[model samples]
Target: MSLSLVLTLLGAIFLLLLFRYILTPLFLSPLAHIPAAHPTSVFTPLWISYHRRGGSQALPAITRAHSLYGPIIRLGPHELSVRSQSAIHKVYIEKGGFAKPKFWADEFMSYGVRNMVSMQGGIGSKEHAGRKRDLGNVYAKSVLLGSGVLSDVAARVLRGMDEVLERIVGEEDNADAEKTGSGVMEVYNFNGAVNADIASSYIYGTDGRTNFVGDVAKRNEYFEHHGTWLKGKHGHAESQKWLEEFGVQLCGPGVSALRDEEKGGADAVVYKQLHARGLRGNDMASETLDHFIAGAEAPRTTLTYLQWELSRNPTRQARLRTELRTLPLDPTTDIPNLKALDALPFLDAVLMETLRLYTPTPGPQHRITPPEGTTIHGIFIPGSTRISASLAILHHNAEVFPEPGVWRPERWGGGDKERESLEEMRKWFWVFSKGSRGCIGKDFTVIVMKLIVAKMYSKYETEVMEDGNMEQEDKFLAGPVGERLVLRFRAVK
Candidate 1:
């Protein structure tokens, strides 16, 4: 053939390739039927990745996109952001066809091995299920409230809080003069320490307990290292090394802490079950580390906001104290029965309201569509597509939560419609996500949350002194934007 003829044929082939690769994905593909977050999202990831790196702005940005574009929106060439109830139910519940995205392994495998939270591949799911089944009773609502193991841990925490109270009220003689005996206590650190101590207690037993509440400085340093590891600011490996060192500290020399062959703490309780049913060493450590890693930041974020809200409302604080007094725990020393605390109407309202307003992990809970494809809200999402639903978006949904931004505990108490209202709220209450992969520690976390709230508000009246960065952070595991809260505690008369 002549050179001119060859050039003409080449040009025609290039045109065909453009139509197949670009034009089809932009205008003809199944995802093309859905609204695009940005026009380029039809064929590229630039739009979504840009926003993902947009920091805290990412939540409001995606939230606005759903508000403007309806429930299903294409965020990338292969990514779908679904917010509709029908879509959420299909992707996360009824169909349950989507698997966690690939990043979960890298995100959670920091403990030198993968735990159930990071489990992947074929048998990995079964392995996770097996771990949950074997250990499920340990965190069950009935068992947790009744378990001597948790009760002992709670008793320890309550005792620690009592000490913390003394320092907060300037009653302790050896209290760090600079750190305590003042009304202005950094409860951000206090909450974190309490959570860390409890988590460590369960993971490492009473002997290896971390007394963060007792020593605020130690918790400050521990969490500083912990946060560095999470944000990967300096570098992930360096930060992770620090965290792993801390992990070893939590588990070392305490496997037999509750000796006499009467091991009762979680370290012994879970280890025995896991070993008898097959699993040891790193497997044991990974799960324990999962608890440490998963449990720490949640309570920190939660208590800060709950206190912030209460500080803004003095009457609510007084009423909450009245409700807490009904628990019957001695204001100075005694611990309340967990069951009675859970049954408190006002305490339940405060916790449920906080979680709804400030869902801890408000970022995307992502899942990939199955090989056979799936339909969300009547829109057919092709197989192998990346899809997700944001709890932040779901929680603020106007229809489900009227005046979504307002913090009104009364909304949770609807008398005759109380059961009906709570059932409806649960549908929109995506703080912990839903479906098979829902947080196993939801009840566990709630128990701890209610317990602490019950204990703290029972005697102390908190005043928010300096709450500069009160905004919630924009990361996957986020707290207030300020990341700090300074408050004054006055003993309730």
Candidate 2:
């Protein structure tokens, strides 16, 4: 063929490629009807990817997009961010839930194995349901309330609180002070230690639990690795390995015999359930490791922010203490009954408000549309498109939560009054999310956090000594900026 003929063919092919790859996605596709977060989002994921990389400003940018573009907006060429309740139901509940995106596996898988959180697709969903069934009874609200597991967990939390009190009092005594607790304590790390201990004990029983609360050196060593693994800091590979090995050791031979005496030699609930389900060796270990991962950091984040809020408002803190004191203490243990502690209206309000305002895992949970596709909020999202809903965005809806940024526990109405408003707010609440894929550890998290808060505020009034950079970081497991919450816990007279 002549050179001119070849040149003409090449130009034609180039135009066809442009139409297929760029023009179709940007202008001809159904997703083009949705508003783009950035102009580049119409044809590429580059804009949102840049924001999400290294935990950069994704949440803020998405929030702004939702505010400007209504409830549904295009996040990338094939990705969408949804905020309406009806859309959430359609995606998460209507058809047995959408498959999780690859990000869940890439980010959450532990010990080179998939747990429920990291699992994906039809097979993964079946396995997840099976696992949930195996462990459902133990995590049930009634069982958790009645069992020795939570009782032992509560006792352990109190012991941790004792150490905190001692540290504060000891430092003050050394400084020749007369009043109790004039010394500053970094609570974020301590809270992490306390949460880890609680989670391990509950999962493996007291015998396999780490005594991080009593052992500062051990807590520091563990947190150093854990924080490194979580944040992708330098040396993260080694840190990740160290964490996995630590989990493996806890699941070694004969570790299953570790039992709680209070339960009349009942084996550790989770380990027993996993063993009965025929998960042995690394499988069992990896499953337990996932529980540890789930249990530790989020509660720490909750407690840290809860205390920060309480410290900033002394009147509300005082009111919480009064409500806490109303619970009749167990004469022997000197701690309130787990069920009664859970029933405190004011305490529930404060916790609910904190969860609403400063949810730890407030980032988007990415899900993929089914192969056949479906409509979300009247918009027909195409098959296999990436879509997500954020707990942070839903929790901050101004219509549901008036003055959304303010810390007003009363907005929850202490569980009785404002019935209509409270119902509306609850519909928007997604802290633990909803539907079959919801958090399996919801009861565990709430009970442990309540126990810790009940124990702390009952005896001490916290005051912020130095809470610099308390703004919560915008990440999957959001925590306070600066990773420090210094406060002085004054003894309540």
Candidate 3:
């Protein structure tokens, strides 16, 4: 009961607490055996979170960690990043045990409603599967390539191309020569406009679609507002409300047109599918709004990068145009056959290479471990551990992709000798991710990108006008940091 006796007991308890909380996790835990991205990573997530805050710092730092430590590295006390083919199969492919973290829900929820992207575990998983099933058919590769879907998509894309051409080459007689004639066009803005126009056509039907592609003033307004809202220039609450109202406005016409007894247009593909499965009101609107959002962003990033890359390399552009010339043209529309376009070897090579280098969703596709736990690269990860694999890292594996930073499409053009290397590269390609929960809109995005690229290159030769600050932004769906890609177009003649 003396004061000295009390002090000795207090020191004993403090040492026990330190050993249990800090020392054990730092040295004795199974996760400690894995390579740490930073000295504090074994006990705290602060290091990783600090780097990942904003701007494009996390990617380079993580890439360096993988280089120093091999395939799997501990990003935090409970977070692991693996960049191996085996990890991809086990985490994303082998069944669906690794569920998405709430990050998707927090970032992707539309109209304050959960769609597939925002759905987590529990009944949410089942609901997501049902929603995917309802809308699967329209986005299927076969359906997208079919005459019916292709014709509708082609009409929309080509109409957008007309606006682009008019903007670039100008009309013969116009009061405003500046708006009409050959000059620098912002590829990023035009890319979003066309993608939005095409995606909405399929979502709501052609009759209810936005004419952003055809109407230059309207497209400028939409993109400008989006930029301002994203920067939080106006208050967050006000910006979010404006976004919600925009979603409603975007969806209203399609919903009304679909209900019409004498609706005479291409099928409201997504709406019909969802209605058939019994979703109505905000439920239907959330799913459609998410689709419109998806349609607008990632594809636009891909197209922008594709144009930027091709514009910088004239020989590649010449080669691509030569390949495009071989496509069989449709007698009626003058557009090439969609199937033939997909088959062009050089065109496919160009696209595959662009996706490899500038993956839009280059950030980690995060997944949490099962309750049972699992081993990755010989290191045992505990249950409910946070795990992820970044396309930015995997796609840059120098072994799979020699000179990983270089933009070389010929790497994808595997002849007899490079077949083995080509197969290895494909195994590491996670641009869309893989498995049951992979991107449902892959086919739609791919076909649309091909249509736009093929049509643009065939008619005009592009040269870079301004490409400063072209480093891609560091976010889930990343674009250029400056969000600008200006290019000058000259008619092929």
lDDT string for model 2 (64-140, tens) is 99999999999999899999988899878775688888776567777788777887743236777887777757778
Report the candidate with higher lDDT, 2 versus 3.
Answer: 2
Report the Cα lDDT for residue 207, model 1: 71
Each prediction's TM-score versus the true structure: 0.92, 0.94, 0.92
Predicted candidate 1 versus true structure: per-residue lDDT over 1-493, tens digit per residue: 9999999999999999899879999877888799988878887888778887734336777788888899899888898888888888877776333577777545777556877778653223576567677675766678778776776787778778867676657744444322534756767877877877776776577777788877766777778877776765566577678777776676664556545346333544544455556656677767777787677788789888999999999988888888888777634437788888788877788888899899888878777887778777666778879888888899898887888998887778722244326778887888878777777787878988887887788878988778887888888778887787877888877
Q: lDDT per residue, candidate 3, 25-73, as tens digits?
A: 8888889899898888888899998997743337777888889998899
Question: Largest lDDT belongs to which candidate?
Answer: 2
lDDT of 2: 0.81
Which residue runs does candidate 1 get wrong by more than 4 Å?
1-6, 9-13, 54-57, 95-97, 121-124, 171-181, 262-268, 330-333, 414-420
CA error at residue 156 for candidate 2, angstroms: 3.2
| Best prediction by TM-score | 2
Q: Cα deviation in Å at residue 473, candidate 2?
A: 1.3
Q: What value of lDDT does candidate 3 attain over all alpha carbons?
A: 0.78
Candidate 2 vs. true structure, TM-score: 0.94
